[model samples]
Target: MQEILVLYYSHRGSVRALAEMIAQGIDSVPGAAARLRTVPRISAVCEATEPDIPSTGAPYAETQDLEECIGLALGSPTRFGNMAAPMKYFLDNTAGPWLSGALAGKPACVFTSTASQHGGQESTLLSMMTPLLHHGMLLVGLPFSEPDLTRTRSGGSPYGATHWAGKDDNIQLTDEEKRLATALGKRLAETALKLHAR
Candidate 1:
């Protein structure tokens, strides 16, 4: 089976939820499976470290995960119009993969969640894409042809899937948001399959 790594960091569970939805969509493709992984929180204190295995949720991701996946779906919660530090921390350590061009030509998509409707979801998604682009991966985004993109009143975007978690981070994803996230995942898997066939 072809694997698409679903890598993400979630503080309030919003981005994690979106990642799972995307994973489900990826697995819906006959030959594709989702490999769910997460990064541990980074500490500001000097030389602090997280446990090797997380207490809950997905385990920490390794560089090999990026190299082995047929495609990638990266997700993170917004931190001041950017990706959260934990996800960024993980991506920052991939210099070896970058040097080896391990991710070159692989299809990649991004997703994000925000605390409010205007909480920089699109910007966060764009920021996440920067690294994938640097790795020479092909970007896959939701197109206007997806009915939910035109109709969504919540977190769906042409750039990627998103969720508005509200100030308290309590809001549930809208139906439109869910559909768009699934659509994005399926699109990524399909594109990856086509590229791999070549």
Candidate 2:
């Protein structure tokens, strides 16, 4: 099976929900598999403060995951229109892959969740793309051709996928949000398969 990494840092389960939907889409492709991984929470006091393994949800991501996956789906919650610190901290430490071009030519997608409709979802998604661009990865994003992208009232975007979690972060994903996320993943997996064919 070809493994596509679904790497994310979800603060209040909203991003994690999106990641699961994306993984579902990836798993729908025959010969494609979703490899779910997550990074540890950052600590202010010291480095390597988080345990090597998390207590729940996906395991902590390793640089090796980036090297091994055929494609990548990156997701994180928005923090002041940027990716959360933990995710950024993890990306900042990817010098090994950056130097070796381990992710070069691989297909990638981005996703984000926000506390409100205007809570910097697009900016967060764009920010996540910066490093992948530097790594020479091929960005795969949703298109307006997806009906949901044109009509979704909640969290769907051409840049990738998004969710509006509301002020309390209690809102469940709307159907449109779910479908678009799945579409993004399916699109990404198909692209990875085509590239891997070469």
Candidate 3:
């Protein structure tokens, strides 16, 4: 099966929910599967360390995951109009893969969750795209043709998928949000398959 890495850092479970939805879409495609992985949280104290294995949720991602996957779906919660630090830290450590061009020509999509509707979801998605672009990955985004993109009352975008988790981060994803995210994932997987065929 062709594997698409669903890599994300979800603090309050909202982004995780979106990740799973995207994975579902990826898995819906024949011959494509989702590899769910996450990065460890960064510590402010220099001496603090995280366990090698997380206590819950997906395992910590490795560089090998990037090497192994045919496509990528990157997600993170918004942190002041940018990706969260852990996800950024993980990408910062990807110089090895970048220098080797391991992700070149591979398809990629990005997703984000925000505390408020204006909490910088698009900027966060755009921020995540920078590293993927640097690694030469092809970007896949939801198009206007997706009906949900035109009508989402909560979270969806042409740049990628997004969720408005509210100030308390307790809001469930709207039906439109779910549909658009799934569409984005399907598009990424299909794009990867086509690129591999070339």
lDDT for each candidate structure: 0.92, 0.94, 0.94
The sequence of per-residue lDDT tens digits that candidate 1 reaches over residues 19-40 is 9889989999999999999999
Q: Kindly report which residue pairs in candidate 2 clash with one another.
A: none
The TM-score of predicted model 3 comes to: 0.98
In candidate 2, what are the lDDT values of residues 30-56, reduced to their tens digit? 999999999888878865587778888
142 in model 1: Cα distance from truth in Å?
0.5
Q: What lDDT does model 1 reach?
A: 0.92
Give the candidate order by descending lDDT: 2, 3, 1
Clash count list over all predictions: 0, 0, 0
For candidate 3, the per-residue lDDT at 108 reads: 98
Residue 129 lDDT, candidate 2, scale 0-100: 98
RMSD of each: 1.1, 1.2, 0.8
Candidate 1 Cα errors over 4 Å, as ranges: none
